[model samples]
Target: MPELNRRALLIGGAALPTATSLTPASANAPNNDEAFWREIAAEYDVTREIVQLENGNWGATPRPVQADYFEKLARVNRDTSYYSRRGMGRDLMAVRDRLAEALGVPSDEIAFTRNATEAMKTLIGGYNRLTPGDAVLYADLDYDSMQDCMKRMALRERAEVVRIALPEPATKASLIAAYAEAFARYPRLRLVLLTHVSHRTGLALPVREIAALAREKGIDVIVDAAHSWRQLDFSLPDLDCDFVGLNGHKWLAAPLGVGIVHIRKSALSKIDHDLATAPDGPDQIGERVHTGTLNAAAFLTVPAALAFEARIGLDRKSQRLRALRDRWVVRARSIAGVQVLTPDEPGLYGAITAFRIAGKTSMRDNGAIARQLLERHRIFTVARDGVERGACIRVTPNLFNTMAEMDLLAEALTELGV
Candidate 1:
């Protein structure tokens, strides 16, 4: 239950890097070298028996962050009661402050949650503005749980639920047009759930434009940016929405259970505070969600993780992930039957991409391909459904992954018979 001293943390020799010292020279490297990334990969302790290309699920922390997490976990375990009563709250708020600074928002406007699901459940369900007969909308590409939350919100409000399909071969124009048409069709729509990046196909939607469009129609947009925030080079305000749910574990490389809920101060009035109580201030962002007791150690590890990411630099990280995706996708497209699901546009994707053999759109077929990639080629992947057309095998490469690993996946696709 010790109070965290910022000066001490900064000067805590070998424990946390200083503000100016952590930046790696390679952050500006012009070439992607196996040796260069291997040096970075050394910071991870993952198994090399299989090439892990499924990092979209949860980002693994680097060794430095992991060590710090373990140390803090031990400290919390040694004096649970003392830490919980005296020190935990202060440390938690400090983490929230760091998160706010990193996210370009005020600390009071953000709150920590167990994960994106918990945050979205609180936000989508607690939103108090909807009334009977008003419609809420979501797309096929939105996360399944979030879509479910929107449906439940609709049911609770006696409001109609409107679902739409995004355009195939998605382009900026097509994406905008499809949403515009849906808005015209559902004039009573009150809320919309937009995924910044579709987990199913790794398609990065133009969220800023879509949020603007929704605003024009007098609709509030709740952005599901769990997959896009750290994976892509952008900030919360860049999405131009008042409500957003973000995942720290997925892209920020924080511990497994950290996520964030951001509510613009002006928009705070729309979401009702969860578990009304004196401590749960009606206007406080933290009051919007109730997570009984959380892992203090994991929450404390966020600053370390943020430092690691900043040292590497987001622009460098973003460009590298996209390059890795393009590496395999370009080669896969040359195969006779393979179809890359993500668009080839520069800004349309990040580390994740999904693909299927021509006509192999069923869940079973896509699952088989994912299994084959693991069993036959020793390359890890996942089968994803919920896209408008069908299912596909999703591949995501992390910072530790090399081009050789990506080529192996591309080669495996060419050899796998549909």
Candidate 2:
């Protein structure tokens, strides 16, 4: 393949004749205007081979960000340890500062990890306040790894692990009530894991309300915002949680292997330092988790991703994504034998949503349904399990996705529903 086609295929899964060939939108075009979105879509090199609705895994870095990543990768490769040991620290700190500004947190409170999984692991394992007989709570919607970490910590500290099931068809008030009830029922609950946006069904939880409830009960909440930071228009303060784990690759469109760990300055004492010592003192947030070496190129490319998101504006991006989500979900809900997992209420969902055909609740059933959608309709989706009720098929669209693709998915579901 030619160099242009090669890069396009590598990043977007297909070659575009020329990304710029698409007509530009008017400067005054409304945010929801398809022409405006098409212009934004032109920034990415999307595959023509299939309708991609599985963007929840990770975002495809825009061409500009990808170019910046390649340049940084080349520089790192050429400079090697000489640059890494001497000059890279300053550059890394610069990236951290920029990311901190974007997240509305102090630079000292946030640390970069390979991904949210590593970030949350450091927070969960390093948490030192738990005591024997005290309870640490999590819900069925929490990520599997974090759930396991909570269980392990409970085992190690002799604390009780309390698992609750979030209410289905959850509303803002009902969601808050669930946590309030949990907190009241488990008086010994010292810590709780809250997922801002569930990876299983894309149910966006009211983290701020739930955290406030936990706070009133003297419970500390650690939020898994791996899917929410950029997917939804919010900041760390908006969540009201002192500790959070987020991802850049999911919605910020940075290269893979970039994640964040945020521990409020005042709350730092709650988490112990990593088992591995660092040259930096224990007072610094960087010492919380020592991953040793990371993809310096990926971390360095974050500024470019932030810059891209800045130009588009996070608020506008959130609206655009929600519009795409609602476009299909409205149709899918009306189809007989189809069950929409996430509610239609505002602030409860984003670009990610899930659905299942009635009577198809097993992992095998949903997996087959997802495969059939791909094979028959060329619409791609993923099967998700562990939603307490049963398995589901998650559909996630990114900035590059067209509204028509969501309709294709709805149509596919309709056919499958029969």
Candidate 3:
């Protein structure tokens, strides 16, 4: 196996690592070397019977991380409350420190939650700065639960709910313009929910640009970065948002039930404390979210997950994912009756991409397409709705996946597209 030189990693256009930087050996070595990626694929234990492309729900924990998690689980089972009451707090804090460092934020500004949904709920529900007649905005592509929460928050605060539709076949300029238009149309907008990566269409939004637009209008932005954190090579500072909800299990490949809530230290007071009493007081980020009796093993295994990713390097991981996505999307776009929903523009997409067959906009139609791919082609995918345009089949490939698998998916879609 070829050894990866850490010094060769360099981030380039649209935040993706340059191809030359990804070469493991001499400059002549191909960035997308099949032999090197196959070695990386060996770290995961996936089924051989099927091509698993639907990895967006949650990532499969790497073998090493899984082993660490099992060990922690057994230790917690043996010690029970004796361990929980004594050293668990300290251990958890250390985990938070490591996570905070990875995310480029202070340890005190982040807290753990069961998942991104819980963290987002905390940020959206606990936002207490709204006044009567103020408005909160969300788009069709935002998570359904988060949108519902925004509506409920509006009702509670006597604020208006401004729901908008993102433009289909969107461009970077159009996406930014859409938000700017919304902010202008709703002068009283107090808050907006921004999904850094739309789960429905796999559309990667220009978060920092959109957040900047929201800020000019004095609207607080709560970013749902559930799918973007490790999948994209970016840090918290790059987003420039005050609050964000991140998922560890998704791209980080951590054990299930681990998520992160980030509230910038300067903006901590904007979000009210969790309903549960905070013994640590209002200033502490942990007080902002209270999920009682979390899965200790899952939380304990996060450092191991981070370690595995560090070994591979986020720049390489992200570039490899995009390469896999492009392998299929470029072919799918040329196929008859297929519409690739996510744009190929740099920084506009990542590993996750969605496509729709001609005239198959209904949920049932897309669902059947997903089933067909599974049953006939032995490939796994998911049907997603809630896009303003229509339903689509979402394809997300993990680090374990190979170029051949992507090619197989494209061939399957060609057969089904007709």
| Residue 292 local lDDT, model 1 | 79
lDDT of 1 at 90: 91
User: What tens digits encode model 2's per-residue C-alpha lDDT throughout 261-361?
Assistant: 99999999899888797546758778898998899999999999988887677888999999999999899888999999899999999999999888899
TM-score of each model, in listed order = 0.92, 0.94, 0.92
Off by over 4 Å in 3: 1-30, 278-282
Poorest 10 consecutive residues of model 1 by lDDT? 6-15
Q: lDDT of each structure?
A: 0.84, 0.88, 0.88
TM-score of 3: 0.92
Model 1 agreement with the true structure over 303-356: per-residue lDDT tens digits: 999988876778888988998888988898888888887898877889988887
* Worst 10 contiguous positions by lDDT, candidate 3: 6-15
| Winner of 1 and 2 under TM-score | 2
Model 2 C-alpha RMSD to native: 4.1
Model 2 steric clash pairs: none
